[model samples]
Target: MTIKASDLLKYDITPFLFGVLYSRIMPKPTDDSNPKHFYVYTAFRTSKAVLKTAFSLSKYASRLVQQYNSLSGYPNWEIHKSSDNAIDLRLYIQNDLNIDAAQFYNLVYKKLRSSTWLNTATINEDKKYFLRGYMESRGSVDTSLKLFAQDYFYNNRFELKRVQLLTDDIGLPISYANFNPRNMQPQFVSGENKRNAQFRINLFYYAKEIGFINEYKALIFEKAYKPRARIARDGIIYFQISVPNLNSHVAFIKYINFFTNNIYDKVLTPEKVGILRKQIGFNTSQELGQPYRNKSIVDLFDELSEDKCALCGTSQTFKKKANGRQSFEIHHMIPFHNGQEFDNIANFVKLCPTCHRSLKRGSASKDDQIRSIITILGRHPEVFEYTSSALGIEELPKLAEEIWSLLG
Candidate 1:
């Protein structure tokens, strides 16, 4: 049955889809076995589009099937990013309803594994009710899909890299990942080091079985990927593989590009978008900002968003949340409310708490803040133009003007 947004509290279908998937894809602080009394319900996106899931919560996010419960408990703070006034929701909820993660995971897995959720609701209202839930950030859907496909064909540990890195003369993943990164050149592993290596190998197999991975790449990956042996710099033998045939590689390439490219724009109708939002509790970049290639983090952030503090040259603090997340929050170079839209990361910085709060405190004069931000951003005035549409920076300080004029 076709669904109507009007009947569904005017909630756009896309954000709802995002909401449902976000709950499943974003990391959960509490687990079924952990016995934690509570979990956080954090959600805040722009009215125009959902913000990138906060970088803070991104690491723990997984592609494995997860149970999602209802939007339980009210949010405590619906504050905007003091930097750009982007919506920010961070609220903790007690396990008041005894919501079971397993049950939620099963329901979501069954519904979303193959777009069956699109048909589960009889009416638009029901779809809205079913799919609509609190959500936070976009997941690793693109990269995760590509990696699963890569493992299916190449049988290598999938590291996040450029499609170009994976592709070949024919733009396919026919190349070997013999050079997968390693920090230490030491040739040996023992104890936890050995255990972690084994775990990662196990993770490769686990990642292959994920329902979403199988749904898209099952045909091309029907044959079990064979790993050939290789000697690593660490003087250890490791499994390696690559696509042997151009045709097979092309097929795999198509599978990856399908997800990496603008599949939503090609496939989704407004009605479909609405249906997905109402049914899945989510929308994607297609509904919000321009379609973005999320798989590649290359050049995603300006130097401002780098780990160390620009102002004090302090390394990122190592404060881990009770939820086991390393603390890293996005901070805008120019204040968002000073006339900026919550734009791309070029204008943002991933900051530790001390500096993040200091810059956000509004104590510094806008002029002084601009000077500090410009320095932190490596004094590149390019972001002014990059974020100009959202930033509407009314005036740059005299120093900033000199840099901007020179850069232009």
Candidate 2:
């Protein structure tokens, strides 16, 4: 509701500082029938860009959490006493008391103006020791990033399969992905397991955060991503996130051009190179994390009732004329050839078993699936054609570059 912080001294801040401040949210009301059931959604300061447009009641709040960390110790912002990470907060609030939107905006703006640091004397001295100690106390890098990723993937947990099929070796293909998750329960890292329990915990928190707001979860990748490496016990773990279906070959060509054009002109960090390569290469499962059927994903779709037939677009209520059986099956809308091109959530759908088998067997064609999607989208036929063309063009160069690198 209300937030205040010291200053936006970027030099003294750490990512962990942001996490700490983000952990707090306005408490949920116990009474379901209460007239004022307003909610506060929490996210990274960077995320303010996205959520600001969606939540309309007008009260908004934010704070900058600063921390310094080192091998010796860190600081804790929660206690507010001062440990290692120097915690300075900037708080802002938007209130909707009159149930009037205009008044709420004024209240929120006024709250932002009032936020200031409580401990001005301590942070001004030295940020390094204070910030370091705070981060150390906050938690491990694994813990922090897991929380961040969990929150990011919270809305469409089902999309986790897409992330896995693209990145993990053990992930299911689009067609087989609709099988009951309860059947595959043994294969996953259960909530009971302690190995990387932080990832699971963060995932649970993420699911709740998205579920609470009743928002549709979707994954959007940046067009270009810089790569970075983390020191593993052996070599290094190079990772990058990018738009999934860019022309791989074209990407490589453009990247080569960009590098030849700009590498020498700027300080090309290992991260930048890493970003270029995340989309390319034979990413071994050993270097990357394993894939498992994410229950979160299943829960997401279950909540949305999105498991309609991928081929015939039939609902579960549909029954077979001959057998009188209910319908519902997972279908890989994209052919196998397109798997490498685009088999993410946008391309997968639930279909009746009869349609699924028919599509696979070629008794019925994917044209049905395409037509259904087109009808649902309600756009010009050329919209699909040109979109596919653009998608193919974008990835060709990147794919070519990858091939050349492999051959060379």
Predicted structure 2: clash tally? 61
lDDT of 2 by residue, 212-261 (tens): 11111111011012223212221112233221221222222222222222
Estimate the lDDT of model 2. 0.28
Per-candidate local distance difference test = 0.31, 0.28
lDDT tens per residue, model 1, 89-173: 3323233334454433333333432343344323233233222231112112122222321111111111111222223211112
Q: Worst 10-residue stretch by lDDT in candidate 1?
A: 194-203
Would you estimate the TM-scores of all the predictions?
0.23, 0.27
Model 2 Cα shift for residue 36 (angstroms): 10
Q: After superposing candidate 2, which stretches have Cα over 4 Å from the reference?
A: 1-308, 311-331, 334-341, 344-346, 350-371, 374-408
